[model samples]
Target: MKKRWIVLDGSNIMHWKGNGADLATVREVTRRLGEMGYVPCVVFDANAGYKLNNRYQDDAELAKRLGLPSARVLVVAKGTIADEIILSAARDQNARIVTNDRFRDWADQHPEVEEEGHLVRGGYRSGRLWLNLPDEAP
Candidate 1:
């Protein structure tokens, strides 16, 4: 079976704990997404490391933490946000984005996000992960 490509909003997902940035949460999400048969590519803002570890985290380091190759983990340039990169990656890959954001701000620019199942939203409930995605990956 061919695995579909999918994008993850690392900057947003790292904060899933509601306390501070958590790399474990990101890893868990990545693992679950992969188990669902999607190739998960994560994009993070420049300061993700600082928020999570109070230090800089390059793509290689983050990728190692997520058990993915550096190429699949992108840390955008300083002052650059990850939203556009994440959305663009999803568009280019023709894959859905796993994020809680509706991308309403970019609705005019990224109209594809409005399509059904374009964004796979999910979160941890009592330590269990649940994603609202189609049973079959496209």
Candidate 2:
């Protein structure tokens, strides 16, 4: 059987303000995803590494703290587009995107996200992380 994968929009999620975007929030999200049997792969904007300079040694360290393998966490190269890279990776793996972004700009690349179950959204409720997938609708 094919393994289920969840592609995370790291940049968008990390900036989710008070929602499911902080370091602890992301860790919780990953834990939930793992419990559900989905492999969570995260992709971040290249600048994410630089922004964390004060917090950790480098992006690798940050990823490690998040319980993510270097191979599973990708930092796009400078001048590259994070959204495009994320979309490409998700398309290649046939994974569902876990983000709050509407991705209006990348509609051409992911027209199917408008369809049910193609995109997954994350939210916090009662101090707990919750995942909402279009597929979960009855």
Off by over 4 Å in 1: 136-138
What is the C-alpha local distance difference test score of each model? 0.88, 0.74
TM-score versus the correct structure, for each prediction: 0.93, 0.84
Report the CA-based lDDT of candidate 1 relative to the real structure.
Answer: 0.88
Model 2 lDDT-worst window of ten = 50-59
Least accurate 10 contiguous residues by lDDT in model 1: 129-138
Which prediction has the highest lDDT against the true structure? 1
Give Cα distance to truth, residue 2, candidate 2, Å: 2.3
Please write out the lDDT profile of model 2 over residues 1-138, one tens digit for every residue.
Answer: 678988888777775556433565666767778778889888878777555443323447657968988778877777899889888888899888888887889888689678766678877666556688543421
Model 1, backbone clash pairs (residues 3+ apart or across chains), number: 0
State the lDDT of candidate 1 residue by residue for 17-122, as single tens digits.
6778898989998998888788999999999999988999999999998899999999999988688898899988898988888999988999998898998888
